[model samples]
Target chain A: MTHILLRHRDIPDINTLNVYKKNGGFAAFKKAVTKMKPAEVTEVVKNSGLRGRGGAGFPTGMKWAFIDKNNWPHYVVANADESEPGTFKDREIMEGNPFQFLEGVAIASYAIGANAAYVYLRGEFWELAAFLDEKIAEMEEAGYLGEDLFGTDYSLKIYTHLGAGAYICGEETALLESLEGKRGQPRVRPPFPPSYGLYGKPTIVNNVETLTNVPLILANGADWYKSMGTVDSAGVKIFSLSGRVRKPGNYELPFGTTFRQLIYEYGMGIQEGRPVKAIMPAGASSSLIAVDDKVLDTPMDYAAVRTLGADLGSASVIVLDDTVSMDWVVNKTIHFFKHESCGKCTTCREGNYWMRNLTERIHSGKGTGADVDLLLNVAKQMQGKCLCALGEFSTMAVVTGIERFPQDFKQAVRSNS
Target chain B: MSLEKKYPKEVKQLLAKYPPEHKRSAVMPLLYLAQREEGYITREAMQDIARILEITETEVASIVGFYTLYHDKKEGKYRMQVCTDLPCALRGADEFLDNLCANLGIKVGETTEDGLVTLESVMCLAACDRAPMFQTQGPRRHQVSRVHDRGPHHGIGRGVEEE
Candidate 1:
């Protein structure tokens, strides 16, 4: 099938403004602003059943509809902080097919009545941000942005915001805080970004991939999008295939595509033809799924992956082969969480610090079986107590690794014993 | 030179990106500008940015300390951050980092005698597909710096891709 999100693969110059304009770019933003009512745009999206691609899988249109109409000067922030482990699809989309993603940002701004939008890119994407800044300038020069866009009262100005190396900033509330020049930490719930965000105004924070889907949804209509993917997942998703594969890259596949097909067909199987050991479907946050034939054949949709006791979060599938031990895998992940824990929340901050030592001991063959059990216990203790998902997610690999891959832990403990 | 005096145009553009009332939003970018030439954020840059944004110096420092990219201490001209996160490690990123350190005649976090390069083991950079992948965060350059991810014997890919 031809790629929708990754049209750059088919057309080389789609990144340029002239070629992008020729290939039906910004039409959706224009149509929504000049012709359609904002509610109508929301209605179309609601009917299409498009969900946020940033792990939560929340309905996109419903999120737009939730914007407080009483809230003045509504804001739209694009979550381009693609810091999640094993996820590189957004980076490719921004670099290869930027116009579409920017247009999606534009359309989203119009639908939510936001006059100003910001693309919160990661700091490491220095060149990419400069590229988008140029594109924004191009749109402004072409009269797509600025005062009186399309000769209508509706005007829009899009800006790019760079995030420093903090993974918590990827969270919507934390992203808003980061944009406000504060320490990137998650805020208390009950008033999400749509109600109180980016300086206490109603703001809609959508993932770059989620916003990238907007222009097409507006141009092609709801049915065209809903026609693709499974009933639950209503559009194509970019599966970031990586690890121990011959051809590791982003595969823009429909949600119903099988993990087996992604790793075997698209990724060309494990490196050196080694047998597949496990799969981290959601990067480090995933509960390690034992890669059996049955699991491989399962569809890669959100609901399908959920049945396997793991999420399809961001669809960043990190394939693991037999050469890697599960104990060492958890150790690496625990270390990452420890390094990244923002220290804002006790559960995450202390939990990760505590787990890191146990994992280090076990992996280094300096701990008893009791250490593995203690690590799992510490992870469970922090599960529901974390202020945000990062802490809770820190334990998924630990709990699941100990329960599922007892042999690996047993070997680590026995070596030291 | 301070950020304002050195790059006035860049400073204005950064300030213009956020609202006049909410100029504090530009702190991250301003910090980036401060680090652009110096390779590390200077004390004067922090104070200047804090003043420009109507924020406190400590506020700017907190942001600098929170994020990894904004360094307070001066370091090498090139900071080659390797992705030794789980996925990258699975594809021999750890071994790649080790070999690069050996080749450079330095440890993982140490700088070379010439202060040309400093290799670091960082968390996942979302480039998991490209194992042993890294991003250089010092001077700007057009060429792609190559650091091969294959085991010790593959030979170093090439010099730092970005200047």
Candidate 2:
């Protein structure tokens, strides 16, 4: 009910320096720099049970702890390349509550002993990046970020880097490759960013929303941070509600909050009071969740979404009513994935292209039941074999559309054929 | 256009990270430099950059084509790209685009004959709420020094005074 990770919702104009400071914005950074040791700060974050909000849900503290401290001049990269379809929560935080996100970046940098933190934003976010640059300069002027922050040895500089509008860059390692001024493509993991990243140095990469939550976790203490969400997935999560909802916007609720509460209560119910037919709980990347009473009442979190055979990735809930044909939805998502595919891997690049053609044919009312079966087969073939999540996640809608809403696909096929 | 003078010593130093044999590794920075110099990448200038990188012109062309930031042709002084994606489209984007076009006296893909502004339709620019937005690139510069400091202007930078 109450916002934890996204306190800016309650506090107006948090983007402004004065308002942010008044709400004790930079307190976490100050504490981390002045009083607490970097390791201690990392320990607090580790104990808070904060996970990466960038789809994977990897523990934030564990990610920070993964940084090879022996590698000097460590780096912290904030993944602001939120290109996932139906995701807009990060944009809100970066544009409206930038300073809070910056403060979180600062704290994370300190915890990881990083001198420089780069916010790798999507190229479309150039204006936001410029705004963030101005904010960073403001923080630097205020001594909140710069040489000897808070008059301590802990120094941090925040830089904003823009991606050239590649969906693959949203993948952490691919983001690093792009930040290092390369073609945005995913690198092999296991050397996973911590050991080798950004010109081959230890790097800790976290999503924009994930970093935005750090300030709250540090300022409120680990136990306080843990008190908000379900026992496992603690703290509040921002759900970017879109499609068919009256109040389609970002809703911040505790991790375990149910989909019913998010869509009905916060979203002001479906637009025109239409009957909810389906839901994409986490943008185009998530498997479709049938919006029945069981799913509506299901707790909205990383773990709970799994029970419904989906992920709470970036909490980009795309609601669909009976009016929207499932075939059309899958086709749209397939088109996006196909166009945005980086072509670094075979499965995603080729699979998405093939699926897109089939989906287009299906949505055009030309595809038959055999075509639907072929699309499903292609999507299944793409699973577990993508170079990055973009390829892997692209199959979600296609697979789920045929599996859960067979009637919609069947009707679409018959109508078209 | 040569980057010798425009990038200055600091940028040159930064560019030095790539080996002489593989100067193509600096394509991203070079693209940024070109953007800074000419506001946006042109077809000829991009080909020239490919020449400098020692890579095939097609490779460079594909890179520029893939990314929305690099414009293939000349853009107007003010390019307002209104995103017509689902989110913005849902929030009266059509009306917003209509208003913008009406005010600018231009269509979605046309630039003002005076080269003052260009209206374009682009995929999600990542700003959903503040949707129906567009960005403008300033005019292209006329002069830039060559890499060897030999004052021969190439590409779009030819025949203008060096800054």
C-alpha DockQ of every model: 0.64, 0.17
- Give the top-scoring candidate (lDDT): 1
Q: Summing lDDT over every window of 10 consecutive residues in candidate 2 chain A, give the lowest-scoring window.
A: A1-10
Candidate 1 TM-score, true structure as reference: 0.97
Chain B TM-score in each of the candidates: 0.86, 0.68
**Each model's number of backbone clashes?**
3, 2
Interface RMSD of each: 2.3, 5.5
As a whole number from 0 to 100, the lDDT of residue A209 in candidate 1 is 95
* Pairs in clash, predicted candidate 1: B144-B161, B145-B160, B145-B161
Query: What TM-scores result for chain A when each predicted structure is judged separately against the true chain A?
Result: 0.99, 0.97
Candidate 1: Cα lDDT at B15: 86
Candidate 2: CAPRI quality band: incorrect
Over B13-96, each residue of candidate 2 has an lDDT whose tens digit, in order, gives: 435644355466566656766676446776666676677667777777776776767666666655555655555554555577
- Tens-place lDDT per residue, model 1, A46-97, is 9988999998999999999999999788999999999888999998999899
